[model samples]
Target: MDRPHWSVPLALVWVSSFFLHFAWEMWQVVFYEGMATASHAAAIWICTKATFGDANIALAAYLAAALSVCSIDWVRTPTGTPLFFYLAAGLLITVLFEYLATEVLGRWEYNEQMPTLPLLGTGLLPLAQWIVVPLVSLYATRLMYFGFLPMREYAANKPA
Candidate 1:
């Protein structure tokens, strides 16, 4: 069968981005210069801030990957589309969709968990999940979607 193709591979890729983001943040805390200079407690505080909460770098990475993968373009018409632009659009769509979904779940003004609902990333992360997610998605979409990604003639048809 068709390589058991479902959404598993793509989903895994997105999940991987989360751990990767977390690991990178951890590394920065341990190795980056002038990091947490005040004390060990200070260092932990910095690490915690970078890794969790609204602006949490780690969580932001996951969100970015999720938006990116979901955003990939599939041009229906014949007029070819730019991969980067398609990626951008996808990202933008993901962000907008997410914001709308969140709002529907619970209006921001009343949300204690997310105090600053109107200003995403001021309390969130990506100034525009609109732009950042898609830039990242460009790679993911190209990797996953055969439509946008060019086929290699060298790779023959799969075995029966």
Candidate 2:
């Protein structure tokens, strides 16, 4: 089989990551921040888009890490990374983004409403949000593209 091109898969992953992260961030903000007021539609939309930007930053970080690894011996292609390594790269990248965005850049703030880890001083929801949503998105994308899940196979060979 020919090696798969990196562009399409990377685009798909980028979009999937954006939406997945946006949805999870929206959920957390609504439930925890009490920002679900009917009048807050515009605010909700803005917040959702901000999270989308965050997701895009994460995708860039992941792709950078993947390309860096691809330059190494074992992983030769950008898309050839193992899932575990991909996830680990994303986690580390996102943690750094979170720290810089919250602590350094003052882009956003987390209140007492968010569950904080002792040493990290960061919310658990945001940290876990990257993990759960991206993994599910990747799994679903794999199932769709690779036919990994069990399903009825239609036979083209058998004809009446």
Candidate 3:
């Protein structure tokens, strides 16, 4: 059967991104006292910020995967482009963006409960989620729809 339209995948990615980031933040709240004692408004504000930020990250990941996959034929898979590409690009983008935001820009801070990683100087949970969430999103999207239907159709229609 044919897969759903491009919007289907996009919606899926967007919703998944929101939920994943919220959950990540909650994990921090529980373990790292990350706003755990904050008032209801503070918690909502924090989650809202994370959701917005992650939405952008998700969009960047999709863009990077689509652009990279278009140039490299080997990366294409039956259902879509390779999930690994998305995962790798997502991780790289998220890590760099988050590292700058937290460490360099001083936009955010991690608590003592956060697990640190060498070189990254960031929490293990955040870095790991970039890998986990993107992989899950890509895999789920592929299962639900074909890989980038518009691009696939264009390539099929282009001159041999």
Candidate 4:
């Protein structure tokens, strides 16, 4: 079946998100590089260390929350949400889910290298992923799947 044209706003959201994935990868590179510079071998260890224990658990919890929200298609407008607001909401949702799941789900626990006032204070890495990438990714995926936009159009129309 053929797909109809996407509303321009949805196209912008989709295109922006496509670029944002690259942006996140760049950030991750910076993070990993920073870790490496501290000491190459030690950086690898530290990076792995970052994912250790309950931190992994908390990270998983964050992904679940973000996935749940993303799955909803509840984003009200397919075009966009206020930029800062959407990101902030995504952050809140990720943090809340990680918090509640650790407190309630018991499916996992946080890998806190050192426990702090906040259960997994260092778990910010995972939370950031959920907020910045996955939420927009979800939006982009829906835009394509629902025929608000389609990959074939994208492929053909991509600038030469």
Candidate 5:
């Protein structure tokens, strides 16, 4: 089988990740102190910047998965070890960044509404965001790459 051009999956990963993370960030803003009080434009700008960062993280995770599986096309049939790498990389990056931003750098603070882990104190929503958004992004990438049809049907009907 011909290998897909690298750009295809990368582009899909970025686009899907950006939009999904943008929505997640905007929705979870209320959990962050001062975000609810911020001007609409300011909130949007902050979320947009964060979304770009999230998208970059997603791309990095995707690349890690690809490297683990030795296939750029792994997103098409994500499972087992590659999927583990993707999730692990995203979670690790998110945990470290969240700790730094919240504790060390003072980049942001969780409001009273935010539920946090005990030791790390990372916000639950952000951790959930990293887990949920990347999986959904990968699924969306697969659907977009393989068309709207179900994967099994698409595979069976595809021409050899």
Candidate 6:
């Protein structure tokens, strides 16, 4: 099979990551202090920005996976090592950033509802987000890339 252009997988990753992360963020907002009472517009804005960050992290993880296998097409048929690199990179990044943001920078804090890891105290939701979102995004990418999810036919010659 012919390799898809690099942009194809990248676009798929961004779209999938943004949508999944945005939904997760919205759902998990109540676990964060002050988020549940924020104005709708403010909540949307905050989630959108965070979604973009998540998308960027997904892109970076995708790149890391690609580099592990020495091909951007690894997403087409992901396997052991590349998949490992993808998940590990995303988890590592999320843990470090979550620590820095919550502890060092005081960027945000978890409410009592938010469960945390034992030692690092990283929120369980964010760690699960990294794992779940990337895996789903990669699965979505594979499905789309293989045409399992068909696009609408727009041929000019077909029945009008």
**Candidate of highest lDDT:** 5
Ranking by lDDT: 5, 6, 3, 2, 4, 1
TM-score of 6: 0.90
Candidate 6 has an lDDT of 0.88
**Which residue runs does candidate 4 get wrong by more than 4 Å?**
1-81, 113-122, 134-160
Model 5 bad stretches (over 4 Å): 154-160
Scored by lDDT, model 5 comes in at: 0.92
- Give the TM-score (vs. native) of candidate 3: 0.72
Name the top TM-score candidate.
5
Runs with alpha carbons beyond 4 Å of true place in candidate 3: 31-34, 71-81, 143-160
Residues 1-160 of candidate 1 have per-residue lDDT tens digits of 1342445434543443344434444544433435535487776665555333322332233334444445322311112234344444444544554466445543222123322336542223333433444344434543554433243331343232
Worst lDDT window (10 residues) for model 6? 149-158
**Compared to the true structure, candidate 5 yields what TM-score?**
0.92
Candidate 5 positional error at 69, Å: 0.8
- RMSD versus native structure for model 5: 3.0
Per-prediction TM-score to the true structure, in the order listed: 0.30, 0.68, 0.72, 0.34, 0.92, 0.90
Lowest-sum lDDT 10-residue window in model 2: 149-158
Question: Alpha-carbon error at 127 in model 1, in Å?
Answer: 3.3
Q: After superposing candidate 1 on the true structure, give the runs of residues whose Cα lies further than 4 Å from its correct spot.
A: 1-3, 23-125, 128-130, 141-160
- Rank the models by TM-score, top first: 5, 6, 3, 2, 4, 1
Model 1, CA-based lDDT: 0.39
Error of 4 at 67 (Å): 20
Model 4 Cα lDDT, one tens digit per residue, 38-98: 5656544444433333233323333343354562233323323343444555566556665
- Per-model CA lDDT versus the true structure: 0.39, 0.61, 0.67, 0.46, 0.92, 0.88
Comparison by lDDT, 4 against 6, better one: 6
Q: After superposition, how far is residue 48 of candidate 6 from its true place, in Å?
A: 0.7
Clashes of each: 3, 0, 0, 4, 0, 0
Clash pairs for candidate 3? none
Clashing residue pairs in candidate 6, if any?
none
